[model samples]
Target: MTAAQFKSNRFDLAVDTISRADLEEVIAWLRKYPRLTMGEESKRFEQAWSKWLGVKYSVMCNSGASANLLMYAALESAGRAGKRKVVVPATGWVTDIAPAIQFGWQPIMCESDPVTFGLNMDSLAKILKRDHPENVVLVHVLGVPVNMTRLLALQKQYGFNIIEDCCASHGSRHQGRLVGTFGLISVFSFYYGHHMSTVEGGMLCTNDEHIYHHLLMLRSHGWLKDLPAADARRIMKKYRVDPFHAPFTFTIPGFNLRPTEISARTGSIQLRKLDATIRRRVANHLIYQKRLNGAVDFARGIPGDVISSISFCAVAKSAAQRRKIIETLDKKRIDTRIFTAGNLGRHPFWADRFGVFSAPVADKLYRGGFFLPNNQSLQGTDIEYICGVVRKALE
Candidate 1:
């Protein structure tokens, strides 16, 4: 490809999904001089997110990484983190497993699935059988729904709690059910490039009331101020605390991972357009899949699942081929990156402490995976053009 051709078409790996109109909405809200901290707006966003996600409760936090931390904290606070041994995926982001290490939990890494690039069921089964972990954390890698059918069956058989990281998998579904709804607690990111943007925000969702209460306390300074009135009163009475001091009472150790009213306001605005954004991304992803079929290998996902991908991840035949394709994409002015962490196990964070995790699929992804643009801004033709660039590079 010529440099002139590169200047003609530019494709970004991530285009901010938050529109000018959405910013206008935030500006309007700001002009009202509303409360800008975690208040009514945050509550509204949480409720809206819960309703949309088909979950009973949702807690908004500063970032998805914090949400992951809170998930581990809540699990321990609620006495649900048995043995503190968790099964984490080798293909997911580091934060998915970092919290385990931070909490001094024993994290057993599982291999990536060949089809969905999620946790390999056979590998997870092996972990469950041998390790008997208390929890299993899985990411719907790049918006492709994991094999939830097999995963759920394994959960039933192994009796392990499930925590899902749906940060990049918004609107993805497995067997007509949403990805986040299946886990004991699921986390979502509303970062700038995701399906929606709250500037820097995330949500922790769950149907368990006890866990929900624990999340409220864990989100703040482990205080009862954010808890429901009845629950707070019950806690106060149990501890023989006075009403004056109950609100400030620290229940369990927590952090100030609170979202600002501005983020919450933006989230409310972005939430309105989330479904539309998801539809566009999903459509664009399918176009990439169909066009790049045999030219490069990628996740096919399950037959009935929906993929609302943040980026289309493709695996070249070899590391050399991947380098060539990335070079071509760069020359074409198309933004691309190595697949999300490729293998967290190979990263220094994990490798320094534990030896390199070697598995066929994970190692292959580590060497060959690359991300292509897939955002709400791209259309079918854009995807086709990108695929053509990749196919030509392969040739």
Candidate 2:
């Protein structure tokens, strides 16, 4: 049975992740000082994020797309390990593929697992065996954690760099470790609809000291001033700059993608409630698993992985069937969407340039998969009713 409150309302795919109290807290702080640019609050948020993600450093930026760009730029600037080819999943956002091409790196797209919606290791292993790409960008699509233990083993055998894109995944884990900590560089998005929200912000995380410094420069305008004290001195000695000019030194090509004090303050407040948010999202997702497991093609978390469940994804048996299901959901006042940009390989941006390589699994998802509303604000009845609509549509 539908809840009385929800009977007359259209269920939305996302809600404002920011709480009213958190918004008030930021307003009160802003009124007191009026300084909203990147500052101590940004630093505080970065440190806290690092601690939570089990990484050494986290640099805040304007958006997750910028975080992706900064990561590729940093790797390119540092001179990648004699390997120019980067492998990315075909089922990721455009930013994931665009940055690699923009930075002059050759990116080969791989198929995604129908269940996890991450790079299929078998498919990736085949590409690694044939082409031997040095870098792999792994997106934990829709908050489902990839099996890192197996992926890391393949990394050891293949000797490649891993860039974990955890933009849709916060508080997600593979085994016991967090998703963002298992790679050379990790990225997160704190946009309005994600696990947490800073309104419009992202973070770049790394454990390596040099890469950390590189990210700092990339986030700002490639100035030595952004470097830590010792690192700044090292740069000064390397360049042999005048003491007065050292502070103004530009080390590498960079951009102005810094976050504001307002976003950082929001992030700080939102981070505290992330655990509770995940609990609600996961609980709602379990209803989908219990009710619609064999009836529809839904995203499934790998064994021993804790999913953040940003949304519930359903793949209809055919493209025509998907359209009918969406129509049914619409009539039921349920909202639905395509699965995360729907296979970047099939899109015009990639098709016009490289020509589309057949990624059967990703292509199938592109044609048939649609997203169901799953968020912190959804309750038991909402989840059940949404899934019920799907079951009836199939009937």
Candidate 3:
């Protein structure tokens, strides 16, 4: 008898696949810390993460949003919190802006070129006409660099700090530098569907000692009371105040955004396999671009930029065609979505905000924007099936 052909239904593909080693790591953590103490697991995870990013420090938290929040909060506590505006990608997730608001900083959202799926430096240039903010949050959407070179040049000219949001861009590299290392304080997400998974976690990194210490304190409660005396002195000198005394002295106003022991343990195991995962994902993108070339247009990196494809987003001939194509793909149980929230300018909370520019390009793409599954777990057959399904939908 002939063997039945392998097939996976929508139900089978509903969740992302977590490797056995990943699962084993979590189980082992639970065995070691039944109640999940925040200790060695967390410390080891931070160390592993710093080594992975090639940065001086890596701070762990419960989620990427938390990571963003902690980074901004650290900046705030270190004294750039108010009267400073932050330039952010006008095309990313909502949490990307939350940190700015939570820290009392004005968020100047910049439009992105939907074609390139990266930040539009022209918009940034226009806004920086007067004076640049001390903190410029440069979020790399869908694993693509946001004109980092130009942005960095502008930052150097105006003296603004760069904060790279690599939540969807864990392994992405730009000019031989990892995404996280490019910014003063960068963030990474290990959400289940990301390039790697620690179930749900985030990391914050920086080469700056002051930012690193502040991030550590803000990850927990506002109390720097438990920090080393010399660390407290360093912070005090930066802030020009005696905020803390000896033990139990409240240093900087902070919050407890700590990661659990399991998350840390899971992250460490996953880090070991990150390079392999990224290679597979990158290979899949090349094959995807090759197979779907004529049928689809793609985003090219800047003249000297290298991109990491977070999602396979594309422009459709028309909005209706896009919807129909999405429906057709849905019928085949192939999950897909828009590049990033359609466009940030259209959102009610942001649209009515003061000082926000009309994101014409990003808005146009939002109407026609769509994405397809680019998960590393997808096999050769899965890619072929996806391409086949897309062709049918287009037809």
Candidate 4:
């Protein structure tokens, strides 16, 4: 397509990473009348995912939210979820914190950092001193890598397990390390319009062997069927159960969050093109940052870190300015939306439980943060044009 023709089309906040060719592959596989349930395809996708993310194990689930739920459940099942006091981010999707609340953990809301838009280290340190929480969940907000250098130092001192919500940050890196690799258990989403699409799916990844075993059982029905044969045999010996009844044996209380073979097959196909997608997104994001610099505020992230942003998030000077910019974007046929959840604390789900989470950076993001298109579909020219529209709106 010509550049002008492409620009004439709607500039979306996200675009499906899956192409017609990918769908054709899926269709061809469907003709085989293969097992649609979680089977070999799911295993292959998980293995491919683990290798890509540099993790030892990966568990595919129904959705990213399901992966978050599995992370909490895995912690508890492994007997490592101490105190049930988990620190959650103020500027992330609700799922980042909701699982903590649903799992009956005391959720302490942390402020957003001015630069990275992830957890504010100062706020987290204060919480560590005060609440003494055992776990902290953070999102690489909008694919901007959190300041893991500081967060990891805090983890060492305070000794809290890190649960990274990388659902929107598939290829983000901090200090040359992948975001998901830093956490005890990290989650990624493969829903439509994300880094990639499996139609609907998520992945839970970890390096710890014990946590890996628990994730395998918890992803299904807490049965030994999915567990490694060696692990299953050991468990059976411990319970004095015979091999005949082992597969049906229940271990920990689990949920049915299995991904279908179709989704898994789609995921494997999408994974192949993910690196190219990341490259295009990274280039587009740089264009946004360069052209819009000083004209608007956005997460700068830590220096030297790679940001594989899903969308180019910018904060207008005020709420009125944001409305004006968004209006301009809409008029120009560009898609835009308020930042992810604004502040999760402002939502009724959180407000009803613990009063509005008030903080300088987070409240500002709630009032002024907005998203701009930064998917793999957009080119440098498209981003520059979008930036021009935004800058004109600000004037």
Q: Write the per-residue lDDT of candidate 2 for residues 1-395, one digit (tens) a residue.
A: 35522643888788888978988898888889867888889999999999988889999999999999988988877776346799988987899889877767889999988768899999999999999999999999888888788799999999999999999988788987788999899999999889999999999999988888988987889888778888899889988987799877898988999999999999999999998998888788789888998888876878778888788877888999999999999997787899887688888989898998677789888989899988888888888888888999999
Error of 3 at 41 (Å): 1.4
Task: Please write out the lDDT profile of model 3 over residues 62-155, one tens digit for every residue.
Answer: 8998888887788777775546688777777788787776656788887886445667877778778765667677777777767777877887
Candidates 3 and 4 compared: the better one by TM-score is 4
lDDT of 3: 0.73
Tell me the whole-model lDDT of each prediction, alpha carbons only.
0.92, 0.87, 0.73, 0.91
Q: Give the clash count for each candidate.
A: 0, 0, 2, 0
Q: Which runs of model 3 end up more than 4 angstroms from their true locations?
A: 1-8, 11-17, 225-229, 233-247, 303-305, 355-357
Q: Residue 384, candidate 4: how far off, in angstroms?
A: 0.6
Candidate 2 lDDT score relative to the true structure: 0.87
Q: Is candidate 1 or candidate 3 better by TM-score?
A: 1
User: Tens digits of per-residue lDDT for model 4 on 1-395?
Assistant: 33632754778787788889999999999999999999999999999999999999999999999998999999999998998999999999888888888888899999999999999999999999999999999999999998999998999898999999999998988988988999999999999889999999999999999999999999889999998898899999999989999999998888999999999999999999999999998998888889999999999989999999999899998999999998999998889999998888999999999998899999999999999988877888888888989999988
Q: How well is each residue in 143-185 modelled by candidate 1, as lDDT tens digits? A: 9999999998998898999999999999999989998999999
Residue 80 displacement (Å), model 3: 3.7
Off by over 4 Å in 1: 1-9
Reference-based lDDT, residue 129, model 3: 75
Worst lDDT window (10 residues) for model 1?
Answer: 1-10
For candidate 1, the lDDT comes to 0.92
Give candidate 2's TM-score: 0.97
Model 3 residue pairs with clashes: 220-255, 222-254
TM-score of 4: 0.98
Clashes of 3: 2
